[model samples]
Target: MKKIIISVLLLGLIGGASAYYYAFVYMKNRKFDMVNAEAASVDASVLVKAYQENETSANASYLDKVLLISGTVSATDQTQMGERTLTLSSEDPFSGVMVTLDSAEAAAVNVNDQVKVKGFCKGYLSDVVVTNAIIVK
Candidate 1:
């Protein structure tokens, strides 16, 4: 009886893993986005609002790849060693949305350069991000 119970439990575990994998990773991978480095520049405000409605919507405009955005370096995270992260927020005449970067990318920007960054639309992160981010740029 104990051996039979263990077999049933093992079967259940395997089935659950298979279902979860297909539902999350497999489906999401079909439309997963990558960044592009070459494209015409766009006004930053137009982006923040579009994402407010849908993340995948901009995939058509930006080639489903990375995008180049222009904004200001509003905040940053200092590092004792290596790179420190910087937060870039929209400088568009209409909004104040924020985006994050790894320490190294963040370091290349400043508080008020009106900088242009090339990264992807990674979705929303609540207070940290209204609807846009350049995760790898």
Candidate 2:
């Protein structure tokens, strides 16, 4: 009985350690540097138009991909969590490309600013969403 209990405890400890290492060490280090990544250069209006015309085709071209988008800022807001966001204007007044800016680039932009941003496309839901974005100079 004692041997069995000891073996079970040891196995449980090993499993817990493996899970911790995979969650913290491996996954934490696996984040890609978005600034240095290869991305498709696009205009904000053009991207919105593509999604508006055909979401399926647009997803094939842009979903989960990094994009460098250029446009005039239509709005800027800070979320409750203090993350800065920018909305870039498209041809359609009702819809725009929404970018969640990285902490480093958040302080340097404003509405009407013609800026370029790089981010990963997170698909569209009324507005096209881009996350982990940084302003491109």
Candidate 3:
């Protein structure tokens, strides 16, 4: 009957609104934890080990913080953006940080030496930075 149709429509609107309300609430509460987790120290060997272990805390620990990671350097073409900034990276299809190096030191870093860097977690798709990397060896 007409009465039955009207009731169903009303119930659908209420249910949809309720779903949206809960989703909003959940996001608000989870944001703090997701963004404030401590940055974990990362090493390639340790990362491999953590990935193998069951329920490792590595990912959560570094969720949204800066981390210093050490790895081999890959040389990139030196470029500049405007006069003040360096054009280090073009756009990426995936998520990660786009980084620029201090122009004076960019040349010393070749494609083979081991280097260390500090960067923050912008998000999963964002990149980690290597703030002020120097050639250690």
Best by lDDT: 2
Give candidate 3's whole-model lDDT.
Answer: 0.42
TM-score of each: 0.44, 0.81, 0.35
Tens digits of per-residue lDDT, candidate 3, 114-133, equal 55444443322233333322
Output candidate 2 Cα RMSD: 3.9
As a TM-score, model 1 comes out at 0.44
What does the lDDT read for residue 98 in candidate 2? 95
**Colliding residue pairs in candidate 2:** none
Ranking by lDDT: 2, 1, 3
Roughly what TM-score does model 2 have, to 2 decimal places? 0.81
RMSD (Cα, Å) for all candidates, in order, is 8.4, 3.9, 11.9
Off by over 4 Å in 3: 1-39, 44-59, 77-107, 126-137
Clashes of each: 6, 0, 6
Which wins on TM-score, candidate 2 or candidate 3?
2
Higher-ranked by lDDT: 1 or 3: 1
> Per-residue lDDT tens digits of candidate 1, residues 1-137?
99999999999999999999999988878642324445455545656656655756654655334556665666655545644444555534334445444433433555765666555554544322422233334
Instruction: Please list all clashing residue pairs in model 3, or write none if there are none.
Output: 95-125, 96-125, 96-126, 96-127, 97-127, 119-129
From the highest TM-score down, the ranking of the candidates is 2, 1, 3
Each model's lDDT comes to 0.53, 0.93, 0.42
